[model samples]
Target chain A: MIRHVAVFRFVPEFTTEHREHWMALVRALPDRIPQLRSMTVGADVLRGPASYELAIVADFDDLDGLEAYTRHPAHAEVLRISAPVKASLATVDFEIPDAS
Target chain B: MIRHVAVFRFVPEFTTEHREHWMALVRALPDRIPQLRSMTVGADVLRGPASYELAIVADFDDLDGLEAYTRHPAHAEVLRISAPVKASLATVDFEIPDAS
Candidate 1:
């Protein structure tokens, strides 16, 4: 499997409602994107100095599956809403070796 | 549960061996820190424009458990080794609500 992890810090103007709407769209992705094996999205609870505002962790069978989800219209819709409000975004895509 | 996600960007000077050593230590953390419910670590595969070098995703039952894992000597040791070579790091700690 491949894991796609994204952490986001919203712009100063981003409001609570914006966050809620964005998270809702992200949480609904697994149902909308067929390539998603599993998905989880969450709002930061700690709000620490190093903390980002939100996170999305999703799993795919392979890079092709991940690419399919990334190009999916549902994901594009979510990004369209989030892109304007995002201040910083960092992502990591990595392989998850099967357990022996 | 609380999910703690950390993504790292290593310094330009950091070499492949340094990354391997760091990952080895991070992968061994669950055995040294009992507060962890589960943990996963991986080096980035995509090397995309927005990609960070590595990611660590760990779960704990609650904030207390998360704190315990964070402050544990073993975790501190890992940080001692990683901090010097790290160029940037971002973290998010968020609640994982139980399924209804």
Candidate 2:
């Protein structure tokens, strides 16, 4: 298994209202990607001296599943809508071992 | 690799002050758990209709490494401090696929 974590840092300018709009776009992703087994989106409350503002957690069966999601058309839409509101984006991809 | 995610929800009574105390306790753990490869802690900003208040992301070399950290003396101290303020706690232990 593999988990893909995309961390985004939004500028203070976006503030409260902007996130709601971005969230709407995010909510539409799961239906678009079949390989996304689990996904969770969250905002960072402890923003003190940190560069990340939001986090997207996605669990997949393997690297290929993660790759499919990354290339899916739906993800691009999210990026397009998010382009204006976000200040920066960073990603960390790691593998998950089998339970047995 | 194995990722241990501890999701916690704190009641409104917690507010800002309580988290600072918990964070201090958290920063001290890495020093004590050599098996703890990486750790990230964040507070939820959306505050929407969710039960989670804090999310802790930890990466370990494998399951044994995770166990070592769990049994380490420092982890006990965290539980003691957290026993009071938390409303609920949930954990998901996942294995990471090897690079090779």
For all candidates in order, the CA lDDT equals 0.89, 0.67
**Runs of candidate 1 exceeding 4 Å displacement:** none
User: Per-candidate DockQ versus the true complex?
Assistant: 0.86, 0.04
RMSD of each: 1.4, 13.7
lDDT of 1 by residue, A1-100 (tens): 8999999998878898888888888888889888998888888999888899899999999999999998999999998988898889999998877670
Q: Write the per-residue lDDT of candidate 1 for residues B2-66, one digit (tens) a residue.
A: 88999999887888888888888888888888899888889999998889999999989899999
Residues A1-100 of candidate 2 have per-residue lDDT tens digits of 6666556656678876777677656655777789988776656543334325666677789878877987999888887768787775545454544551
Index of the highest-lDDT prediction: 1
TM-score, every prediction:
0.95, 0.51
Which pairs clash in the backbone of model 2?
Answer: A95-B96, A95-B97, A96-B95, A96-B96, A96-B97, A97-B95, A97-B96, A97-B97
What i-RMS does each candidate reach, in Å? 0.7, 13.2
- Candidate 1 DockQ vs. native: 0.86
Docking class of 1: high
Task: Residues B35-94, candidate 2: write the lDDT tens digits.
Answer: 988776656533434335676677789878977987988888887777777776545454
lDDT of 1 at A82: 87
Model 1 CA lDDT for position A97 = 76
